[model samples]
Target: LPFWNKGSHSPSNHVIVAFEAYRQLSQVSIRPMTAISSMANIHEDICATAKRKEAAVIILPFHKHQSLDGSLNNTRNDFRWVNKRVLMLSWNFC
Candidate 1:
């Protein structure tokens, strides 16, 4: 297991960006929890950030069963077998 670095700014930055992007969901009249695309982008950003820092990042891909299992299976598969420091928050949906 890789150590968690509290000093990392990437994760926190990703969180803030995610909040801002998702917050627009309400404004667009989109269904709650239906913004899987946005969430996926956020996950990718988080993963990329973690990869750049060589740190472990936990990712719970949104809509695990509906979106993740189908659309994100490839990315998840790649992450699973890769040697990078990362962790899948859940498999086959949360």
Candidate 2:
């Protein structure tokens, strides 16, 4: 799934990333379902999407805290919490 960054510094980059990911996955014969949302509500959006789509798994990227340039830092205090929440919520679906 793709998370939409509504007020991000680089919004177009997110689209490019999503498209590239879709292309690579398509090459492997794996079609992925996608969704978009702001970083703040991504956890809730993911859980809602999973329920709506009846998804068994959710894959998240570290891009939330790290940029495409591979810089690693704690950009958001809730990043860890969001990760944990997504993992726990996905497990409940499974």
Candidate 3:
């Protein structure tokens, strides 16, 4: 899962092509799982997916991007709350 990956917000075709190249050059299998959910259900959605997949760890979305100056920034502060809720809901797996 891409939790605010460097290119998660980029064009899908760009990301796909990069992944394809990486997969071929490295000869490693890459399976991607993607889902779109409303903000209201985001935490629940992530928790459910993690449980269903029996994931050992859930990388809560950092929801910030690094600037050229090496600083992280995001306009939304509520993302912190959502991240906490996701971690709380998935605590069992940890």
Candidate 4:
């Protein structure tokens, strides 16, 4: 969260960069919603955002990645758990 401070950015600015790319590629308007809550409560925030926005779908980044060497790493198990909770709680995905 320190990266969000002035003179800094979100973890090397990847979040901003990704959202900008999405904004460019998407036909509809898209904005990044950041929730400053504990991981345990992240799913709630996600669901709330979707509901307020009347969004039909909620897309979350996968917690895992495959490297060029075919190694499966960079996994955030907490995010995977949160994603499951989001899909479980959000009726649209149900």
Better model by TM-score: candidate 2 vs candidate 4? 4
Per-residue lDDT of 1-94 in model 4, one digit per residue for the tens?
3323456555536766665666676855766665577887889888887888877656687888899999888589987898888878886534
Global lDDT of model 4: 0.73
Writing each residue's lDDT as its tens digit, candidate 3 over 6-76 gives 54456665666676677777997655567888878888998888788876655555668799999988856
Clashes (backbone N, CA, C under 3 Å), per candidate, total 0, 1, 0, 0
Q: Give the TM-scores of the predictions, in the order they appear.
A: 0.22, 0.45, 0.55, 0.61
**Best by the lDDT measure:** 4
Q: Which stretches of candidate 1 lie over 4 Å from their true place?
A: 1-37, 57-94
Q: Which residues of candidate 4, in runs, are more than 4 Å off?
A: 1-27, 92-94
Cα error, residue 86 of model 4, in Å, equals 0.9
Consecutive 10-residue window with the lowest summed lDDT within model 1: 28-37
Q: What C-alpha lDDT values do all the predictions have?
A: 0.41, 0.67, 0.71, 0.73
* lDDT rank order: 4, 3, 2, 1
lDDT of 1 by residue, 31-79 (tens): 2121223433555555565455554334443322236445633445533
Winner by lDDT between candidate 4 and candidate 1: 4
Q: Give the TM-score of candidate 1.
A: 0.22
RMSD in Å for model 2: 7.2
